[model samples]
Target: MRIFVCIKQVPDTETKIKLMPDGSGIDEGGVKWIMNPYDEFAVEEALKLKQTAGDATVTVISVGPKKRVADALRTAMAMGADDGIVIDCENSLDSFTTAKALAAAIKKEPACDFVFSGKLAIDDNAGSVSQYLAEFLEIPHVTVVSGFEASSGKYVVTREVEGGTKEIFELTGPAVVAANKGLNTPRYASLPGIMKAKKKPLSELNLSDLGLSSSDAKVSFTNFELPPEKPPVKFIDGDPAAQAKELVRLLKDEAKVL
Candidate 1:
């Protein structure tokens, strides 16, 4: 069996982000990049599935600038993926165009038995790519998956929903599964695995190679700016009863929540 895991290179959550002077986008300088944390779960689940199947191969795929995305793929290889494909593209593509590019890239390789990805990228947090990919590939997809098992040539997945309930699904054919956190513990890259990853095959392709272009983007971003500075806190100086009245007055007149 062949499994494909999709990942994204994103700014580390702790990294301080700066906007471009013209508000076109964030400044890339001095930014620390890493694989999306949720994608790590997807990769770990793929590796676990590979271990269970014993004859399976896990291929990691990403769409982004060559150097950064390639680095993310190498990290996945260090975690046990067999090979990788990097679709060289601008970092700002919308989710639709991104999914289209991924589907095209997957079609260029041998057909895969399953596709795995994070529920969403940390940067955009759009939480839409895997569904779009399944649509483009004409396959079923389940997102926010927390449990996964395989039996009888089918996959049974469990996902949490609103109201703290869980929904289970069984997919009998090739399908896409977007992993959420708590699915598996991601392993850190070891010294030997890191050394071996340096030799793993990584293919790079361009948007044109995938029959896509910048015009295919369905959404555009603009007017990027930081949120306004918060106002200072105000104190109510009064006894308990008076404080309650003042709070109610403030809420009704000043804050307008009443």
Candidate 2:
């Protein structure tokens, strides 16, 4: 079996974020970067699948600035990925363009049974890459997957849905899987694993290497801004009936939910 897992390097959640001088992106200076937390689940799931099959190969792939992505690939490899591939993007790409670049790299492989990725990257929180990748690959994709079972070329997966519902799906190989939290506990890289990962075969790629150009990008980032501060809560204090009436009035007049 040939499995491909996509990951991203994102700012550590606790790190304070600041905007760039041009307001087009984040200010990375003094900020710590790590493999996206959600993608860790995806990588762990891929490794588990490979272990279950006993003869499968897992390839870890990502697209980002080369300097930032190198450590991410090394971390994935240390977690037991068989190989690693990094795509050097000249500029940060939106989800669609990123997925396009990833899809092109996956196509370069001889054959792939599965492609797995995190449901969302924490930095942008845009949980759309797997859907776009599936579209580009023209395969079935199950997102927010929390459960999975595989035998032969068939797969059974449970996807988390709104209102605490879990939707089960059955799909065949050559599909995409968007791993979510609770899928599996990610393992830490052991000393030996880290040493071995340092020697693993890693391939670096560029847009030109994939026969892609900047013109292929369909979206652009014009500016970035922090979210507005949340308003303070207001209380309706009065007798029971008066409070109820005031609550209704507030909802209708101020909250606009009526």
Q: Which candidate is the best by TM-score?
A: 1
Best by lDDT: 1
Residues forming the 10-long window of minimal summed lDDT in candidate 2: 213-222
Per-residue lDDT tens digits for candidate 1, residues 174-250, read 89999999888899999999999999999889999989997889988889999999888899988999999999999
Candidate 2 lDDT over 1-258, as tens digits, reads 899999999989999999998988888889899999989999999999998888899999999888889899999999999999999986657888888889999999898889999999998788888999999999999999999998887899999999989999999767889999999999999999999999999898898887877677776666898899988888779899999999999899988998
Taken over the whole model, the C-alpha lDDT of each candidate is 0.93, 0.90
Off by over 4 Å in 1: 235-258
The number of clashing residue pairs in model 1 is 0
TM-score of each: 0.92, 0.87
